[model samples]
Target: MSPTVASTGRVPVTIGAMESSSAASGGSTRREATRQKLYEAAVTLIAEQGFSATTVDEIAERAGVAKGTVYYNFASKSVLFEELLRHGVGLLTASLREAAERTAAEGGNKVDALDAMIRAGLVFIDRYPAFTQLYVAELWRTNRTWQSTLMVVRQQAVAVVEDVLRDGVAAGEFSEEIDISLTASALVGMVLVAALDWKSFQAERSLDDVHAALSRLLQGRVSGCR
Candidate 1:
């Protein structure tokens, strides 16, 4: 999936939610908390300064941990970055999947599922703008060490939207001539760019305002007659 940008804040919403779920399930809560800190620090620092310009020492310092703690969690700065990308995107994929599944369970149609996923994407971006920005920037660069990892996670996220589009076509809810892959990519791109713009340029606007505008577009009301 395409990534975007925003300022870093507390632990990302999705990640924090995942951590809560994991903790309830008897998972390693402490480790996850530490990783969350590192992820937050890395995203902020790397987003502000390019990945190469950011160092393990700086990440550890920002995270309020020793440099050795960084090495303990990740073999090197590159490994830490690769895992950070995976972790953040993985949470995003889960959120999208949950939104789609929840919509289906509620007897919503394919369009509804897609719209729900759009909101999920916006929420994720709104929560972790710096991470989104970092992810998007890495996607444009072909030389990154984690480029392969990035591609895999990206496809995993986009595949959720693609699946919904395929279902829509199968059910005759969408035109068979429509390109599923491209349309899925387009929908994701729309939310990513729109949400980034909302966070960066139109910070005064509420999420509901952005979602309503995008929902209108999804419902084919672009002419504003409906």
Candidate 2:
């Protein structure tokens, strides 16, 4: 399982099982730090110029690590990006799962769980804008080497939303006519696009403001007028 952004502090191993290869506690910490740096560098470059344009050397330089360090941690740039996509999306999925579980534990309904998942998505995007941007851009494109791996990761995250929606439908909170899978995908898309828009084009709006807007839309309070 990939560690959360908060727990792992935003980065780690790829290209191989380098993260867990070290058994010494001190060495493991250092290795984890190096991997994090590399991930941070890779995500920024890939998000800016894209995976094809970004190189290992550039990632190493941006990470303040030697070229061999990149090789030491990851087998290749593709592996690095693959691990990155897995790790980032894994964190998002885990976050949503925890939020849903926590909400349910607190006697909240599936609608509340869904709301928590949406906010969790926003928070994840806010913390890892580069990863979110890269994923959003690449998600619809075809023929990429990493696309298949990413699809599985994408499904894991979306499944969290689908679970909550399914519960809502079963409990009569949501309409039986709702297509749970489609609605879940739409909700995930909504959070991703809204977060990117807020970060890229709508700097004046606060995160709270954006969240409120999304919450209203989810609660069916927004008018359908175009």
Top candidate by lDDT: 1
Among all windows of 10 consecutive residues in model 1, the one with the lowest summed lDDT is 1-10
- List per-prediction Cα lDDT, in the order shown: 0.83, 0.81
User: Which residues of candidate 1, in runs, are more than 4 Å off?
Assistant: 1-14, 17-30, 224-226
TM-scores for all predictions: 0.87, 0.86
Report RMSD for candidate 2.
Answer: 4.8
What are the candidates' C-alpha RMSDs? 4.9, 4.8
- The lDDT, on a scale of 0 to 1, for candidate 2 is 0.81
Question: Tens digits of per-residue lDDT for model 1 on 55-121?
Answer: 8889888778898988887788888888888888888999999999999999999999988998999
Residue range 1-226, candidate 2, lDDT tens digits: 3432223343342222234556565455667777877887788889999888888889888778899988898888898888888877877787889999999999998878888888888887777788889988888888988889988988898888888888888999888999988998889889888999998898678878888899999888898735
In the predicted model 1, the residue pairs found to clash are 1-154, 4-132, 4-133, 6-129
